[model samples]
Target: MFKENMHTKVGFEMNINKDDVTAPDVIALLQDHLKSMTLCSPPESIHALNTDRLRQPDVTLWSAREDGVLLGCGALKELNSRHGELKSMKTSPQHVRKGVAKRILHHIIEEAKRRGYQRLSLETGSVEAFLPARLLYEKAGFQYCEPFGDYNEDPNSLFMTLNMR
Candidate 1:
């Protein structure tokens, strides 16, 4: 089902819906995220998964649209029965600082809890361009944590987790 939230300040209809990740708008946003990541980190240090990987059975992707325009997207990958990893969070350039990311993130966290996950975690870059994202996660109650899932210690990565239980 498509869940919607109207932003009072913007007076626009924003909807968060589970998406197939193949729609043109979704692909464009994912591409933008990939391009931005490549600019900020080397190939080896970049861990953002491609579309094919995100289509796997364990991942559930969502896209946020405002008045039928794509605003952002994110995914939640089931790491285990009680754990999940947030992935591929990206807000469109025009939508940045307009609460799109926060809405998408809130949706992902709620979905994780609904699935009975005890914790949710994510790995993001440790660069200046990523400071806003780090702050967003921190504001959402995610705290620093050691590397999770298949992740290893990397100087260029910052891992964070939220306890859902």
Candidate 2:
């Protein structure tokens, strides 16, 4: 297990890696967390992310584990030159507001920066249930914008982007 020390809170030893995740693994985590979440209502479609379309080599899959226990997970999908997309960002309900998502977000963002991605973009739900996620993204310097990649105008979705340049 990988560990990173937090300022005061003892960070969990969560090893974010590629092969530790599967479609059912993601489904279980999300079904538990987003069942009643206002932000991520109807999380069933999220299962598709584990499919080949979203799990190709261009996509980087990550999961946080504590003592070999899975805690949370997220993914980064490289879109094109200098751009990347955030996908499947979810924290265990047990670890909500406990810096799990933040850690994963920072890890993915740092990976993107390391890979010379000039920009990072994300698509999240616009419902009230998703406020915490939106706040997290905003605090990470994500700003409102039109949908990136294949997304267009969507009332149910909120799109944001950050320039790493």
Candidate 3:
């Protein structure tokens, strides 16, 4: 029941919760993210996870809603006791540039810190269309880094990591 009234140009009552991923709005968001990723990267390089995968025990998913409108969603995947990864972060198309993604990202990073993770990392498409997302990560203190965990170097992918410790 975490709720915050975001006072921005598009001011909305943003509520963040670890809720069901099968919800209609959530499904739409995830589907849109997957479709967008596929458009920018090869199938083999698209790493966006499906709802079932995001529901795994190690992954904590949160959806942001504003007055019952799903604004965005993000997930923190525990990699180990001291590491975690950001996954499936997406904001509704209409909510873009309204601070929804930034709010969700801050929530995820705080959760990772609460879990005592020493590092938080993410993988995003290395394409022109993804520049905004990359800039968002950079603005949040994430720095370019080498591929981590099970990820490998791919020209279509970019890696970023934030030291939380």
Give the per-residue lDDT digits (tens) of candidate 1, residues 52-97: 8888999999999878899999999999999999999999999887
Spell out the clash pairs found in candidate 2: 38-129, 39-129, 39-130
- Candidate 3 Cα RMSD (Å): 3.2
Alpha carbon deviation, residue 32, candidate 3 (Å) = 1.2
Our tally of clashes for model 1 stands at 0
Error of 2 at 41 (Å): 5.1
lDDT of 3 by residue, 119-138 (tens): 99999988899899998898
Which window of 10 residues has the lowest lDDT sum in candidate 2? 1-10
Off by over 4 Å in 3: 1-6
Residue pairs in steric clash, candidate 1?
none
Q: In terms of TM-score, how similar is model 1 to the real structure?
A: 0.94
Local accuracy of candidate 2 as per-residue lDDT tens digits, 12-107? 456667643455766587455444443354553232264454457787778877777667888888899699998878787776766778888888
Question: Can you give the TM-score per candidate against the true fold?
Answer: 0.94, 0.81, 0.94
